[model samples]
Target chain A: QKEVEQDPGPLSVPEGAIVSLNCTYSNSAFQYFMWYRQYSRKGPELLMYTYSSGNKEDGRFTAQVDKSSKYISLFIRDSQPSDSATYLCAMSGVGTNAGKSTFGDGTTLTVKP
Target chain B: DVKVTQSSRYLVKRTGEKVFLECVQDMDHENMFWYRQDPGLGLRLIYFSYDVKMKEKGDIPEGYSVSREKKERFSLILESASTNQTSMYLCASSYGGYEQFFGPGTRLTVL
Candidate 1:
Protein backbone atom coordinates (compact mmCIF):
# COMPACT_ATOMS: atom_id res chain seq x y z
CA GLN A 1 0.00 0.00 0.00
CA LYS A 2 1.13 3.53 -0.65
CA GLU A 3 2.18 5.43 2.43
CA VAL A 4 -0.11 8.34 1.59
CA GLU A 5 -3.11 8.69 -0.71
CA GLN A 6 -5.09 11.74 -1.87
CA ASP A 7 -7.82 12.42 -4.37
CA PRO A 8 -6.44 13.49 -7.72
CA GLY A 9 -9.33 15.87 -8.06
CA PRO A 10 -9.71 18.51 -10.68
CA LEU A 11 -12.01 20.11 -8.15
CA SER A 12 -13.69 23.29 -9.23
CA VAL A 13 -15.26 25.94 -7.02
CA PRO A 14 -16.61 29.43 -7.18
CA GLU A 15 -14.29 32.22 -6.17
CA GLY A 16 -15.86 32.75 -2.77
CA ALA A 17 -16.47 29.11 -1.94
CA ILE A 18 -14.87 27.11 0.79
CA VAL A 19 -12.61 24.28 -0.44
CA SER A 20 -11.84 21.08 1.34
CA LEU A 21 -8.97 18.74 0.44
CA ASN A 22 -8.08 15.54 2.19
CA CYS A 23 -5.44 12.81 2.45
CA THR A 24 -5.25 9.42 4.11
CA TYR A 25 -2.19 7.47 5.13
CA SER A 26 -1.68 3.81 5.82
CA ASN A 27 1.42 4.13 7.90
CA SER A 28 0.88 5.03 11.51
CA ALA A 29 4.53 5.90 11.84
CA PHE A 30 4.01 9.10 9.92
CA GLN A 31 4.23 11.97 12.39
CA TYR A 32 4.62 15.01 10.20
CA PHE A 33 1.98 16.16 7.72
CA MET A 34 2.29 19.08 5.34
CA TRP A 35 0.32 20.70 2.54
CA TYR A 36 2.07 22.20 -0.45
CA ARG A 37 0.67 24.40 -3.19
CA GLN A 38 2.16 24.21 -6.67
CA TYR A 39 1.38 26.60 -9.45
CA SER A 40 1.82 25.79 -13.11
CA ARG A 41 5.49 25.73 -14.13
CA LYS A 42 6.42 26.62 -10.59
CA GLY A 43 7.75 24.89 -7.49
CA PRO A 44 5.75 23.57 -4.59
CA GLU A 45 5.37 25.91 -1.63
CA LEU A 46 4.49 24.96 1.88
CA LEU A 47 0.94 25.90 2.81
CA MET A 48 0.18 24.20 6.09
CA TYR A 49 2.35 22.17 8.41
CA THR A 50 1.44 20.02 11.41
CA TYR A 51 3.37 17.56 13.54
CA SER A 52 1.85 14.33 14.85
CA SER A 53 -1.93 14.95 14.96
CA GLY A 54 -4.46 17.68 15.72
CA ASN A 55 -4.95 20.87 13.79
CA LYS A 56 -3.03 23.95 12.67
CA GLU A 57 -4.47 27.07 11.15
CA ASP A 58 -2.89 29.89 9.23
CA GLY A 59 -4.91 32.77 7.89
CA ARG A 60 -7.54 31.37 5.54
CA PHE A 61 -6.16 27.85 5.63
CA THR A 62 -6.71 25.22 8.28
CA ALA A 63 -5.04 21.79 8.43
CA GLN A 64 -6.38 18.92 10.46
CA VAL A 65 -4.84 15.56 11.26
CA ASP A 66 -6.55 12.56 12.79
CA LYS A 67 -3.95 9.96 13.61
CA SER A 68 -6.53 7.53 14.90
CA SER A 69 -8.15 7.40 11.47
CA LYS A 70 -4.92 8.01 9.65
CA TYR A 71 -6.50 10.89 7.77
CA ILE A 72 -5.62 14.53 7.23
CA SER A 73 -7.43 17.48 5.73
CA LEU A 74 -6.85 21.03 4.50
CA PHE A 75 -9.66 23.55 4.39
CA ILE A 76 -9.52 26.85 2.54
CA ARG A 77 -11.99 29.55 3.52
CA ASP A 78 -13.16 32.25 1.12
CA SER A 79 -11.12 30.75 -1.66
CA GLN A 80 -9.85 33.20 -4.19
CA PRO A 81 -8.75 33.03 -7.80
CA SER A 82 -5.15 33.15 -6.68
CA ASP A 83 -5.66 29.89 -4.79
CA SER A 84 -6.01 27.90 -7.99
CA ALA A 85 -3.22 25.39 -8.05
CA THR A 86 -2.28 21.81 -7.34
CA TYR A 87 -2.46 20.90 -3.67
CA LEU A 88 -0.13 18.16 -2.51
CA CYS A 89 -0.15 16.24 0.76
CA ALA A 90 3.17 15.07 2.12
CA MET A 91 4.26 13.31 5.28
CA SER A 92 7.21 11.77 7.05
CA GLY A 93 8.11 10.28 10.39
CA VAL A 94 9.68 12.38 13.11
CA GLY A 95 13.32 11.60 13.89
CA THR A 96 16.75 11.96 12.47
CA ASN A 97 16.95 12.00 8.67
CA ALA A 98 13.30 12.98 8.51
CA GLY A 99 14.05 14.99 5.41
CA LYS A 100 12.76 12.18 3.24
CA SER A 101 9.05 12.86 2.66
CA THR A 102 6.42 10.72 1.01
CA PHE A 103 4.10 12.61 -1.29
CA GLY A 104 0.60 12.23 -2.62
CA ASP A 105 -0.23 12.65 -6.31
CA GLY A 106 -1.81 16.05 -5.64
CA THR A 107 -5.28 17.43 -6.38
CA THR A 108 -5.57 20.12 -9.00
CA LEU A 109 -7.88 22.87 -7.80
CA THR A 110 -9.37 25.65 -9.84
CA VAL A 111 -11.33 28.50 -8.33
CA LYS A 112 -13.44 30.31 -10.86
CA PRO A 113 -13.87 34.05 -10.77
CA ASP B 1 12.75 33.82 2.54
CA VAL B 2 14.93 30.84 1.63
CA LYS B 3 15.68 30.47 -2.03
CA VAL B 4 16.50 27.23 -3.84
CA THR B 5 17.53 27.77 -7.40
CA GLN B 6 17.94 25.15 -10.07
CA SER B 7 20.43 25.51 -12.89
CA SER B 8 18.03 24.88 -15.75
CA ARG B 9 14.31 25.41 -16.11
CA TYR B 10 14.11 23.08 -19.09
CA LEU B 11 16.48 20.75 -20.91
CA VAL B 12 16.42 18.48 -23.95
CA LYS B 13 19.07 15.83 -24.33
CA ARG B 14 19.83 12.91 -26.63
CA THR B 15 19.82 9.41 -25.25
CA GLY B 16 23.07 8.08 -23.76
CA GLU B 17 24.33 11.59 -23.22
CA LYS B 18 25.56 12.67 -19.83
CA VAL B 19 23.29 15.10 -18.03
CA PHE B 20 23.96 17.23 -15.02
CA LEU B 21 21.37 19.06 -12.94
CA GLU B 22 22.55 21.54 -10.39
CA CYS B 23 20.81 22.96 -7.31
CA VAL B 24 21.83 25.74 -4.96
CA GLN B 25 20.27 26.97 -1.76
CA ASP B 26 20.86 30.30 -0.04
CA MET B 27 19.36 29.28 3.30
CA ASP B 28 22.39 27.39 4.57
CA HIS B 29 20.20 24.38 5.22
CA GLU B 30 21.70 21.10 6.39
CA ASN B 31 19.68 18.81 4.09
CA MET B 32 19.15 18.75 0.33
CA PHE B 33 17.19 16.36 -1.87
CA TRP B 34 16.52 15.49 -5.50
CA TYR B 35 13.12 14.23 -6.61
CA ARG B 36 11.39 13.51 -9.90
CA GLN B 37 7.72 14.14 -10.70
CA ASP B 38 5.86 12.18 -13.32
CA PRO B 39 2.25 12.51 -14.45
CA GLY B 40 0.68 10.10 -11.99
CA LEU B 41 3.61 9.05 -9.85
CA GLY B 42 3.75 12.36 -8.03
CA LEU B 43 7.21 12.96 -6.58
CA ARG B 44 9.67 10.18 -5.94
CA LEU B 45 12.97 10.87 -4.26
CA ILE B 46 16.16 9.93 -6.07
CA TYR B 47 18.85 11.05 -3.70
CA PHE B 48 19.53 13.33 -0.75
CA SER B 49 22.31 14.67 1.42
CA TYR B 50 22.20 15.47 5.09
CA ASP B 51 25.59 17.13 5.43
CA VAL B 52 28.41 18.23 3.18
CA LYS B 53 30.01 15.27 1.37
CA MET B 54 27.50 12.87 2.88
CA LYS B 55 24.85 11.35 0.62
CA GLU B 56 22.21 8.67 0.70
CA LYS B 57 20.11 6.93 -1.96
CA GLY B 58 16.37 7.37 -1.84
CA ASP B 59 13.49 5.16 -2.98
CA ILE B 60 14.22 5.57 -6.70
CA PRO B 61 17.92 6.04 -7.40
CA GLU B 62 18.48 3.52 -10.16
CA GLY B 63 19.51 5.84 -12.99
CA TYR B 64 20.76 8.80 -10.95
CA SER B 65 23.58 9.93 -8.72
CA VAL B 66 24.13 12.97 -6.53
CA SER B 67 27.07 15.01 -5.27
CA ARG B 68 27.19 17.42 -2.36
CA GLU B 69 30.64 18.86 -2.55
CA LYS B 70 29.65 22.03 -0.70
CA LYS B 71 27.09 22.93 1.88
CA GLU B 72 25.14 25.18 -0.44
CA ARG B 73 25.27 23.25 -3.70
CA PHE B 74 24.01 19.82 -4.66
CA SER B 75 24.32 18.27 -8.08
CA LEU B 76 22.42 15.44 -9.74
CA ILE B 77 24.27 13.55 -12.43
CA LEU B 78 22.86 11.17 -14.97
CA GLU B 79 25.98 9.46 -16.27
CA SER B 80 24.09 7.87 -19.15
CA ALA B 81 20.80 9.59 -19.67
CA SER B 82 18.05 7.55 -21.25
CA THR B 83 14.62 8.46 -22.58
CA ASN B 84 13.03 7.14 -19.44
CA GLN B 85 15.03 9.63 -17.45
CA THR B 86 12.92 12.41 -18.89
CA SER B 87 10.78 13.96 -16.18
CA MET B 88 10.24 17.07 -14.07
CA TYR B 89 13.03 17.21 -11.51
CA LEU B 90 12.70 19.12 -8.25
CA CYS B 91 15.34 20.17 -5.75
CA ALA B 92 14.46 20.81 -2.13
CA SER B 93 16.17 21.76 1.11
CA SER B 94 15.15 21.92 4.75
CA TYR B 95 16.19 21.81 8.33
CA GLY B 96 15.49 18.59 10.19
CA GLY B 97 11.85 19.07 11.25
CA TYR B 98 10.16 21.81 9.23
CA GLU B 99 8.56 21.43 5.85
CA GLN B 100 10.92 21.62 2.88
CA PHE B 101 11.26 24.37 0.33
CA PHE B 102 11.28 23.31 -3.33
CA GLY B 103 13.01 24.84 -6.29
CA PRO B 104 11.38 25.62 -9.58
CA GLY B 105 11.52 22.22 -11.25
CA THR B 106 13.62 21.40 -14.30
CA ARG B 107 11.61 19.71 -17.02
CA LEU B 108 13.94 17.39 -18.94
CA THR B 109 13.18 15.51 -22.10
CA VAL B 110 15.58 12.84 -23.30
CA LEU B 111 14.96 11.81 -26.86
Candidate 2:
Protein backbone atom coordinates (compact mmCIF):
# COMPACT_ATOMS: atom_id res chain seq x y z
CA GLN A 1 0.00 0.00 0.00
CA LYS A 2 1.13 3.58 -0.61
CA GLU A 3 2.41 5.37 2.44
CA VAL A 4 -0.13 8.16 1.91
CA GLU A 5 -3.52 7.88 0.24
CA GLN A 6 -5.75 10.77 -0.83
CA ASP A 7 -8.71 10.84 -3.16
CA PRO A 8 -8.00 12.67 -6.41
CA GLY A 9 -11.07 14.80 -6.13
CA PRO A 10 -12.13 17.44 -8.60
CA LEU A 11 -14.61 18.52 -6.03
CA SER A 12 -16.73 21.47 -7.09
CA VAL A 13 -18.45 23.67 -4.60
CA PRO A 14 -20.12 27.05 -4.43
CA GLU A 15 -18.40 30.02 -2.95
CA GLY A 16 -18.75 30.31 0.85
CA ALA A 17 -19.19 26.54 1.18
CA ILE A 18 -17.08 24.74 3.69
CA VAL A 19 -14.53 22.34 2.21
CA SER A 20 -13.12 19.27 3.85
CA LEU A 21 -10.19 17.39 2.36
CA ASN A 22 -8.86 14.17 3.83
CA CYS A 23 -6.02 11.71 3.52
CA THR A 24 -5.17 8.37 5.13
CA TYR A 25 -1.84 6.76 5.67
CA SER A 26 -0.53 3.30 6.47
CA ASN A 27 2.58 4.38 8.32
CA SER A 28 2.08 5.00 12.00
CA ALA A 29 5.60 6.35 12.21
CA PHE A 30 4.55 9.50 10.38
CA GLN A 31 4.48 12.31 12.92
CA TYR A 32 4.31 15.45 10.84
CA PHE A 33 1.24 16.02 8.68
CA MET A 34 1.03 18.91 6.21
CA TRP A 35 -1.34 20.35 3.66
CA TYR A 36 -0.20 22.20 0.55
CA ARG A 37 -2.01 24.27 -2.03
CA GLN A 38 -0.95 24.13 -5.67
CA TYR A 39 -2.29 26.06 -8.58
CA SER A 40 -2.16 24.73 -12.09
CA ARG A 41 1.37 24.60 -13.47
CA LYS A 42 2.69 25.92 -10.19
CA GLY A 43 4.62 24.43 -7.30
CA PRO A 44 2.95 23.59 -4.02
CA GLU A 45 2.74 26.15 -1.19
CA LEU A 46 2.53 24.89 2.38
CA LEU A 47 -0.86 25.57 3.92
CA MET A 48 -0.94 24.04 7.36
CA TYR A 49 1.17 21.58 9.35
CA THR A 50 0.45 19.63 12.49
CA TYR A 51 2.64 17.46 14.66
CA SER A 52 1.30 14.19 16.00
CA SER A 53 -2.45 14.13 16.64
CA GLY A 54 -3.99 17.52 17.09
CA ASN A 55 -5.42 20.52 15.29
CA LYS A 56 -3.76 23.68 14.00
CA GLU A 57 -5.65 26.62 12.65
CA ASP A 58 -4.34 29.26 10.32
CA GLY A 59 -6.83 31.91 9.32
CA ARG A 60 -9.46 30.16 7.23
CA PHE A 61 -7.73 26.78 7.14
CA THR A 62 -7.54 24.08 9.79
CA ALA A 63 -5.46 20.90 9.82
CA GLN A 64 -6.16 17.83 11.95
CA VAL A 65 -4.38 14.56 12.46
CA ASP A 66 -5.51 11.35 14.10
CA LYS A 67 -2.52 9.13 14.74
CA SER A 68 -4.67 6.33 16.09
CA SER A 69 -6.44 5.97 12.75
CA LYS A 70 -3.64 7.39 10.59
CA TYR A 71 -6.00 9.96 9.16
CA ILE A 72 -5.46 13.62 8.41
CA SER A 73 -7.75 16.38 7.26
CA LEU A 74 -7.73 20.01 6.04
CA PHE A 75 -10.81 22.09 6.51
CA ILE A 76 -11.42 25.35 4.66
CA ARG A 77 -14.04 27.73 5.90
CA ASP A 78 -15.83 30.25 3.66
CA SER A 79 -14.21 28.92 0.59
CA GLN A 80 -13.58 31.41 -2.20
CA PRO A 81 -12.82 31.17 -5.89
CA SER A 82 -9.21 31.82 -5.05
CA ASP A 83 -9.31 28.58 -3.11
CA SER A 84 -9.60 26.68 -6.37
CA ALA A 85 -6.46 24.63 -6.49
CA THR A 86 -4.98 21.21 -5.82
CA TYR A 87 -4.63 20.20 -2.20
CA LEU A 88 -1.81 17.81 -1.38
CA CYS A 89 -1.46 15.86 1.84
CA ALA A 90 2.00 15.07 3.08
CA MET A 91 3.59 13.35 6.07
CA SER A 92 6.99 12.45 7.38
CA GLY A 93 8.64 10.57 10.23
CA VAL A 94 10.42 12.13 13.19
CA GLY A 95 13.70 14.06 13.30
CA THR A 96 15.81 14.06 10.15
CA ASN A 97 13.13 12.34 8.13
CA ALA A 98 10.83 15.22 8.94
CA GLY A 99 12.38 17.24 6.12
CA LYS A 100 11.57 14.55 3.59
CA SER A 101 7.88 13.93 3.10
CA THR A 102 5.66 11.37 1.42
CA PHE A 103 2.99 13.13 -0.60
CA GLY A 104 -0.45 12.07 -1.75
CA ASP A 105 -1.86 12.30 -5.27
CA GLY A 106 -3.71 15.50 -4.30
CA THR A 107 -7.33 16.55 -4.47
CA THR A 108 -8.46 19.25 -6.89
CA LEU A 109 -10.92 21.77 -5.49
CA THR A 110 -12.82 24.36 -7.49
CA VAL A 111 -14.90 26.94 -5.72
CA LYS A 112 -17.42 28.50 -8.03
CA PRO A 113 -19.06 31.90 -7.93
CA ASP B 1 10.03 36.78 2.90
CA VAL B 2 11.44 33.44 1.78
CA LYS B 3 12.11 33.12 -1.94
CA VAL B 4 12.99 30.07 -3.99
CA THR B 5 13.83 30.49 -7.64
CA GLN B 6 14.28 27.89 -10.36
CA SER B 7 16.44 28.31 -13.43
CA SER B 8 13.64 27.73 -15.85
CA ARG B 9 9.85 27.69 -15.99
CA TYR B 10 9.84 25.20 -18.87
CA LEU B 11 12.33 23.11 -20.79
CA VAL B 12 12.27 20.73 -23.74
CA LYS B 13 15.03 18.23 -24.39
CA ARG B 14 15.74 15.25 -26.57
CA THR B 15 16.11 11.76 -25.25
CA GLY B 16 19.68 10.88 -24.28
CA GLU B 17 20.51 14.55 -23.78
CA LYS B 18 21.92 15.64 -20.48
CA VAL B 19 19.73 18.13 -18.63
CA PHE B 20 20.27 20.28 -15.61
CA LEU B 21 17.66 21.87 -13.39
CA GLU B 22 18.83 24.53 -11.01
CA CYS B 23 17.33 25.93 -7.81
CA VAL B 24 18.31 28.73 -5.49
CA GLN B 25 16.84 29.82 -2.20
CA ASP B 26 17.52 33.12 -0.50
CA MET B 27 16.51 31.97 2.97
CA ASP B 28 19.83 30.23 3.65
CA HIS B 29 17.84 27.21 4.59
CA GLU B 30 19.62 24.21 6.00
CA ASN B 31 17.81 21.76 3.73
CA MET B 32 17.11 21.79 0.00
CA PHE B 33 15.16 19.19 -1.96
CA TRP B 34 14.39 18.18 -5.53
CA TYR B 35 11.10 16.55 -6.45
CA ARG B 36 9.20 15.71 -9.61
CA GLN B 37 5.46 16.14 -9.75
CA ASP B 38 3.35 13.97 -12.01
CA PRO B 39 -0.32 13.26 -12.37
CA GLY B 40 -1.48 10.54 -9.98
CA LEU B 41 2.11 10.00 -8.86
CA GLY B 42 2.14 13.16 -6.75
CA LEU B 43 5.51 14.54 -5.76
CA ARG B 44 8.44 12.13 -5.54
CA LEU B 45 11.73 13.20 -4.07
CA ILE B 46 14.79 12.77 -6.25
CA TYR B 47 17.51 14.11 -4.01
CA PHE B 48 18.24 16.43 -1.13
CA SER B 49 21.13 18.25 0.43
CA TYR B 50 21.45 19.26 4.03
CA ASP B 51 24.58 21.31 3.53
CA VAL B 52 27.08 22.32 0.92
CA LYS B 53 29.05 19.47 -0.63
CA MET B 54 26.67 16.94 0.89
CA LYS B 55 23.94 15.13 -0.94
CA GLU B 56 21.57 12.23 -0.33
CA LYS B 57 19.51 10.18 -2.74
CA GLY B 58 15.78 10.24 -2.28
CA ASP B 59 13.07 7.70 -3.09
CA ILE B 60 13.57 8.03 -6.87
CA PRO B 61 17.20 8.78 -7.56
CA GLU B 62 18.01 6.45 -10.43
CA GLY B 63 19.19 8.21 -13.63
CA TYR B 64 19.55 11.39 -11.61
CA SER B 65 22.32 13.11 -9.69
CA VAL B 66 22.54 16.22 -7.49
CA SER B 67 25.09 18.92 -6.75
CA ARG B 68 25.18 21.32 -3.84
CA GLU B 69 28.36 23.36 -4.13
CA LYS B 70 26.87 26.26 -2.17
CA LYS B 71 24.37 26.53 0.61
CA GLU B 72 21.84 28.43 -1.46
CA ARG B 73 22.04 26.45 -4.68
CA PHE B 74 20.96 22.90 -5.53
CA SER B 75 21.09 21.28 -8.93
CA LEU B 76 19.49 18.15 -10.33
CA ILE B 77 21.20 16.50 -13.27
CA LEU B 78 19.71 13.98 -15.63
CA GLU B 79 22.48 11.73 -16.92
CA SER B 80 20.37 10.89 -19.96
CA ALA B 81 16.98 12.38 -20.24
CA SER B 82 14.21 9.96 -21.11
CA THR B 83 10.57 10.32 -22.00
CA ASN B 84 9.63 9.14 -18.55
CA GLN B 85 11.70 11.94 -17.05
CA THR B 86 9.44 14.56 -18.57
CA SER B 87 7.57 16.02 -15.67
CA MET B 88 7.23 19.07 -13.48
CA TYR B 89 10.33 19.55 -11.39
CA LEU B 90 9.97 21.42 -8.12
CA CYS B 91 12.57 22.76 -5.69
CA ALA B 92 12.05 23.41 -2.03
CA SER B 93 13.99 24.63 1.00
CA SER B 94 13.33 24.56 4.72
CA TYR B 95 15.03 25.37 7.98
CA GLY B 96 14.42 22.00 9.66
CA GLY B 97 10.68 21.91 9.83
CA TYR B 98 7.54 20.94 7.93
CA GLU B 99 7.26 24.35 6.32
CA GLN B 100 8.99 23.98 2.96
CA PHE B 101 8.90 26.94 0.59
CA PHE B 102 8.70 25.95 -3.07
CA GLY B 103 9.80 27.58 -6.25
CA PRO B 104 7.71 27.96 -9.35
CA GLY B 105 8.11 24.51 -10.96
CA THR B 106 10.06 23.82 -14.11
CA ARG B 107 8.09 21.77 -16.59
CA LEU B 108 10.55 19.57 -18.47
CA THR B 109 9.48 17.73 -21.59
CA VAL B 110 11.88 15.13 -23.00
CA LEU B 111 11.16 14.16 -26.52
Q: Which model scores highest in DockQ?
A: 1
Model 2 CA lDDT for position B41: 86
The TM-scores of chain A alone, one per candidate, are 0.97, 0.96
Residue B74 error, candidate 1, Å: 0.7
What is the C-alpha lDDT profile of model 2 across B1-111, one tens digit per residue?
A: 999999999899999999999999998898999999888788999999888999999899999999999999999999999999999999999898878899999999999
What's each prediction's TM-score?
Answer: 0.97, 0.96
Cα lDDT of model 2 by residue, A12-64, tens digit: 99999999999999998888899999998888998888989999999999999
Per-model CA lDDT versus the true structure: 0.94, 0.92
Q: Candidate 2: how close is chain B to the reference, as a TM-score?
A: 0.98
- lDDT string for model 1 (B21-74, tens) is 999999999999999999888889999999999999999999899999999999
Model 1 CA deviation exceeding 4 Å by range: none
CA RMSD per model (angstroms): 1.0, 1.2
Candidate 2 wrongly placed segments (more than 4 Å): none
